[model samples]
Structure formats: C-alpha cells, structure tokens
Target: MASFDVESLFTNVPLHETTELIVNNLNISHLDKFGLDKVHFRKLLGITAHHSVFCFDDCLYTQTDGVAMGPPLGPSYANAFLCHHEQDWLEQCPLEFKPLHYRRYIDDTFLLFKHPSHVNLFLDYLNSKHPSIKFSCEMQKDNQLPFLDTMVTNNNGIFHTTKERLAWEPRLTIGSMREPTPFHEARLVSGANSFGRHCQWVTGLQVLRSQSLRCSHLDFVRNTGKRTIIERHRATRC
Candidate 1:
C-alpha cells in the first residue's frame, strides 16, 4: 500500500537554504608590537613573582646529614610572610571594615568587601602592606572590579558567567524571566510539517519520472523487432 494520500494538499512550500548579502567587510588589524599569541600574553600579564624570604644559610642549616629535615616548611614560611603583610595592611584600613572573605594562592590574592567604602579601605590597606606590588584599577567602573573570572562590585555583589572566546561579547541580564508561548510551539510544528511535505513531494516526483522512463523503454523494445528480424534473416539464408 502507498503511504502518502495524494488527495491531501500542502499550502506552504519550504525553502531548504537561505542566502544573505553583506555590504561591507569588517575585519580589524592587529595593533600590538610583540605579536605574541593570546595565551602567551595572558600568561605574561597574569604572572606575579613572590621571592622566598628564607636565606640560603638558614635552609642549609635546616637540612640533615642524609635527608633534609624540619618538616618541609616552605609553605609555612610563605604563609607567615603573607600573614605579616596582611596584618600590617589591616591596621591602616580607612573604612573601619575588613574583608569578609580572603583567598590567596601563591602571589594571587582575592579580597571581598561589603560596600564601596570597604573597597577603598582594602585598596589603601593593599598599598600600605605591599608597597612593592603595583595595583591597577583602570578597568573598574561604578565601584565594580574584575577579580579572576568574576565581577566584584561595591554593593557586596558578585557576578559570574561562562568563559567565552576572545571575539565574543557578553549579554547580561539583571532580573528577568520569560514564559513559553503557544506561538513558539506552533511555529516549530509548522516548520517540521512543511519540511516533511517537501521531502515527500520531491521523492514522489523522482520515483514517478524513473517509472515513466522504464515503461517507455519497455514499449520501445516491444515495438522494434530487431532481434527477431536478424534471426529470421539468418534462417532464410541457411
């Protein structure tokens, strides 16, 4: 039995591919002198060097005859140095508020504050505590600063988003919610139905053409008795 009902009519014809025309070419040129790749540049930019405070003589004295002893206190020494610096910074904080959260990994540090005043306090603390380390707040806007992959703001706010490619732009939303509509569902169903109808129409046309050609060839062979004519001529000559 045939699957399609030829009596049914399809209203809309679906387009398989769409073409777009652009008026201008919008390619930008590189402006940096170093010509280093993005990964290398990021590594160079993010680097922070922390020198070990332990002297060579002290390290040597801590080591034993066969094996180095004294509980492998490298991390302890670094932590102690950082703590001393942090304490000094806290003493001079102007806002009369300290960070609610503090995280540090090697030379990288993160400080979280509750308000704009706290951010100012933290900045002053940082300047006084670690004078050798430089601070750049050029990217900050409206009391918002970027720390690692998050945007930290003055109102005790933190915003996080997925990491994207270099050429991508972020789309931000504050507080918005949307409900699904019947129109969207109908549009999807209509698209699928149109696509299926066009596919079936094309397939039917191809099969019909092929069958017509095959029938025409069979009729031509029946009408022309070339093989029989040749056989009769040979028999007559014999």
Candidate 2:
C-alpha cells in the first residue's frame, strides 16, 4: 500500500490547460452551439483572469497558471480537472500493478497496491504524467498507517480502523463551549458512531473489529470538538 499527496494541488493546476483539457475531454458538440467551446471559455477566463486575479497587501497581480486556492469553485474545478488524468491512469495501469483499493479526498489519495515491487514504479509513472502535478508517496510501516481521521490497518486482506485525533481538533478541557441545541452538541460524542459507520461502509469491516475507546475517555474525546463545532455552527448561522 502507498499513500500519496498531490503537492500544492490547487496552486499548481494550470487554469488554461485544465479548461482546455476539460473541453476536449467532454467532446460535446452542444457546448460549441451554446458558445461554451474552448475558444469562448478561454475568452471568458481572460475576463476573470482565469479566476486567479487578486490583490494582496495592496498590490495587484495575476496568476499565470493555477486557480486561486481560496475560491469555492477552485476545489470542484480542480477535482474535475484531475479526474481526466485519474481515469487515464486507471485505464493504463498494468494488470499486475493494478491497485486492489483506491480512495481520494481532494488531494489526498490512498492506494492499496497488489505488489510491493510495483509501488514505486506506479508513483513514478503518476508523477511523470504532468510536470506541475507531482505525487509524493509513502510506503506504510507495519500493517498500519494514518489517513485523515482514521488509522487504517491491513491484516492480510482484511482492513480495520481505529479512531484518530485529527490535528485540527483542539484539546479537551472542562470549559468547552456548548451548542444551542442538544442534538448538535451530542454529535461531538456521537460522531464516533458516524465514524464507525463510515469505516464499515468504506472497508466492509465488521463494526466490532474497530477500535474501542475506554468508557472513561468518552468525555475527553467528545469534548475536543465542542468549541470548534459550536464556533463553526455560529459562523454559518451568521
């Protein structure tokens, strides 16, 4: 198994190139009739400066390639753009090197390769596909590795998971803030149930095989998200 990160994915995506790629890949004649052809799209992007025009510290500039990281549209556009390449890779992967499982969220990707010998070769091939988008890979130590908020372990062909404390979560304290609704606050503790459900769904592992927290630690675990969760909810409401 190998873990790969797309280095500077959002900032590295070439805007004009990605748009052109999307247009060509779509190959929809109706898009041309609707004036959504590559030429028109490029012209529209010029108006938005490929949606990369911005001012920082009172200076104006334009990004030559890549969309702005902060825009809501950037992620969706970037993911769609990468999908083309991902599909090609899947189609072209050698049978012996084909991954047993693959998963991705935004730029983070986890791949379960069938053979260890093919792992580095696969990573090299992926990185060589595009000069701007490069993948950095890690081979798992032991049978366990961390991805997002879950600790994944492969026991032979079976997969299991354990709860992990994401770095983004704050440490627990007695004075954690509360949500206005009981149901909202309860998810901090109960969210583990969701996590368990997600692990089961993703890996088809029995829920009983998952990591279990000590009863005494529930308060600490649940309370960790209290302040941040409330703050996020309040922000969204405002």
Candidate 3:
C-alpha cells in the first residue's frame, strides 16, 4: 500500500530569518499598502471561506456560478478588476480568461493547460503576484481530475475535478482577530445538490446518469459552496 506520512505532509517548515527579512523589507510594504493582514487574510481566504455567504443586493450567488444566470457576476467582476488593477496578477493566474477557459466556485479553481510546465509557471506566477493566496496543487497522470461530483477531461488531454482541492477549517483562538470567510464552498455544494435533485426530480433516474455525465464534461466546476458529504468525497477522489 502507498503510505502517506500525514505528519510529514503537515510539517511546519520554519520561515528563514532572511526570508522574513525580505518579506519585511519588500513584501510587507506591498501587503500593508493593500491594507492586508496576513493572518486575517489567510483565514478569510482559506478553503472554507471560499463558500462563505456573500450578500449583494439581496440576490444570492455562489462563487462557482453553477446556478447563476449567464456568468456569476461577483467573482467575475472581482477577478477582472484584480486582473486590471494588478497586471502581474493575470500573468500569474493559472486560469486562462482569454476564451474564458477556467472556472472558479469560491476556493476551488479549475484550469486546463497543454503542458505541466504551464501549470507550474502559472502557480509560480500566482505565488509571485499574490503572495497572500495560499495554494496547493497535485497532478494526475492518465486519469480524469475531480470537480465536485463531476470529472472533467479537456480536449487538450488535461483533466480536472469539480471538487475542492484543499481541506480547511477555521481556527479561532483568543487574541486572534477573525477573518471573513468566502461563501463559495457552501453555496456551490448547496446549489449542486439542489440542481441535482431538481434534475432527478424532473428527469428521474433514467436520465440522471446522462445529465451527470454531461455536467462532468465541463472544463471547470466548483463545489465549495455547499460543503456537502458528496462534495467532500469528490474532493478526496480528486
């Protein structure tokens, strides 16, 4: 059996003093300029926050836009603005927006690339551009990637899962300020279940598998909003 060293996986690599110095000298200034607090920002931007509630004019929306009409407006607008405000952000973002090649539902982001280098480059770029956004990546060889309950394999021979890529929970301790959670995860999972039930309700089991299969063909899908058991399973599978 393949062994997983959970402790090793979770080992805390101490930040070098020099690295801290650089961050203090260079990155800290930028972070401060943006009015960002690292600890708070990380909590707010963690995987769980991806599905936090976002109230916009009383119209509910999931970060993934699974139930959205046309394109989900909030994240789309936010990302576009970020891209424009920070040109470097776009250069580093793993998702391709040219033809709208990527999809995001809160913390979960799905992207397609022709080469592994593209993925690495994009990840590196993201790290350089937005040092605030914590990311972890895994590669699947000769298999479909998971996305929510669906699995997506692109025409370019790349695959992605429609599921949350990371597991996160908020740690609220005394003396630590709380961070705002993104509602994408909770919303997407709920929306997917609702949509799935709606499909099953109206279409019945005869067409359920086909509908699910078709949905899985999407290039990107997000499942963070609802935080359901099935969504967790999908993420684990991915």
- What's the lDDT for all of these models? 0.33, 0.58, 0.35
TM-score between model 1 and native: 0.28
**Local distance difference test, candidate 2:** 0.58
Candidate 2 all-Cα RMSD: 19.5
lDDT (Cα, tens digit) per residue for candidate 2, span 86-132: 77787787777777767776677778877888888888788878888
Q: Where does model 2 exceed 4 Å of error?
A: 24-49, 167-238
Model 1 regions lying over 4 Å from their true place: 1-80, 91-95, 130-134, 137-145, 149-161, 164-238
Candidate closer to the true structure by TM-score (higher is better), 2 or 3: 2
Question: Which of the two candidates, 1 or 2, achieves a greater lDDT against the reference?
Answer: 2
